[model samples]
Target chain A: NAGVTQTPKFRILKIGQSMTLQCTQDMNHNYMYWYRQDPGMGLKLIYYSVGAGITDKGEVPNGYNVSRSTTEDFPLRLELAAPSQTSVYFCASSDITWRTEAFFGQGTRLTVV
Target chain B: EDQVTQSPEALRLQEGESSSLNCSYTVSGLRGLFWYRQDPGKGPEFLFTLYSAGEEKEKERLKATLTKKESFLHITAPKPEDSATYLCAVQVESGGNQFYFGTGTSLTVIP
Candidate 1:
């Protein structure tokens, strides 16, 4: 159903480089989130948006920023990328009012050298 | 503060063996508990969600049950294809669109 889609399956960046990970959902969900997963560590929330034009920081938002310009898109931007930011990034969306399960995208594997 | 913890960082079981993974959580007025299975190089797949204590849900060889403090994902006669990382997450009623996740339990069912 192409529930959630993320671009750039894999990426490599040098220290201090900046890039944006694109995420889009076809489910028309109002709640969208960006999370990063590291080896042996569970997924950590980076940033989230409850609806279009609304955004909020999550547990690990130090090096990342997110924007929700439309209901179908939530892009995560990494500024001055560092090794610590090298992790798999996943985007998810859900219908908060329905309390439904969140659907996740394939994920973007980012490696910062 | 909300927190989620999963036990047995990793487990290996022979095909057809049965075992249960644990997810302990603490939240301010629990609203929902979620279980997801993630394969290597893939995003997590939603498995089940429990809204309140004493709730139970089942699908194929997996059964998830929840209590006040914890939830359990029991795999019955699992197959090698069932090998994946199981993640537990919690959402609080008072929180605003925040879901707390555990490190996850990595399970490998060997043939």
Candidate 2:
């Protein structure tokens, strides 16, 4: 089973362009998260969803938005992308149990030029 | 603010050398501590989870131990295949399921 899958493994967007990074999970996890890792930096939370129709901002959510319409999908939208938004983005899913480790996708590398 | 910090941002070890990587954290309420290994250009891979202080978990050549303020990932007789960026994360009860991650330690095991 594909635990977690993210689309557009690599993308380059011009400044002010808009795009969506797609993420889906087959594990039926109740928790989903979006994180961006900048060079030489730790992964910063962008947004998270505990379940379908519930989304909340994390540490760095200034330039991103997320929606969880279905249990299997949580997409992150970037409007008016800036060069500072360039980073490797990861999507992860975890079960409701706190002990379960989060499963991560291959990640999407976005370069805003 | 809930945060995680990993020490020795980079390390180099000879084959068969044993070493330990440290992960210090500050959280309002700790739920769990996690360890992950990430290879270049890939996402973090789960390794171990420690729930409370004095808890330890092991897999293959890796062992992880947790204390109230920090956790240590000890690698015994590490090999070249163990070279990767090791990451640490914490899930706090007060954070509403958000996990905070450390910068990671880049370990290079020379064969």
Candidate with maximal TM-score? 2
In model 1 chain A, the worst 10-residue window by lDDT is: A94-103
Q: Per-residue alpha-carbon lDDT of model 1 for B1-111, expressed as tens digits?
A: 788999989999999999999999988888789999999999999999899889999999999999999999999999999999999998777545667799999999999
What is the iRMS for every candidate structure? 1.3, 0.9
Clashing pairs in model 1, backbone N/Cα/C closer than 3 A: none
Docking level of model 2: high
Q: Which runs in model 2 stand beyond 4 Å of their true positions?
A: none
Write one digit per residue (lDDT tens) for candidate 1, span A1-113.
88999999999999999999999999889999999999888999889899999998888899888888899999999989999998999999999774478899999999999
Q: lDDT tens string, model 2, A4-110?
A: 99999999999999999999999999999999998789899999999999999888999999999999999999999999999999999999887789999999999
Best by lDDT: 2
DockQ of every candidate: 0.71, 0.82
Q: Give the alpha carbon lDDT tens digit for every residue of B1-111 in model 2.
A: 777999899999999999999999988889999999999989999999899899999999999999999999999999999999999999988645778899999999999
For all predicted structures, in order, the TM-scores are: 0.97, 0.98
Fraction of native A-B contacts kept, per candidate: 0.59, 0.73
Clashes of each: 0, 0
Q: For this target, which candidate reaches the highest DockQ against the unseen true structure?
A: 2
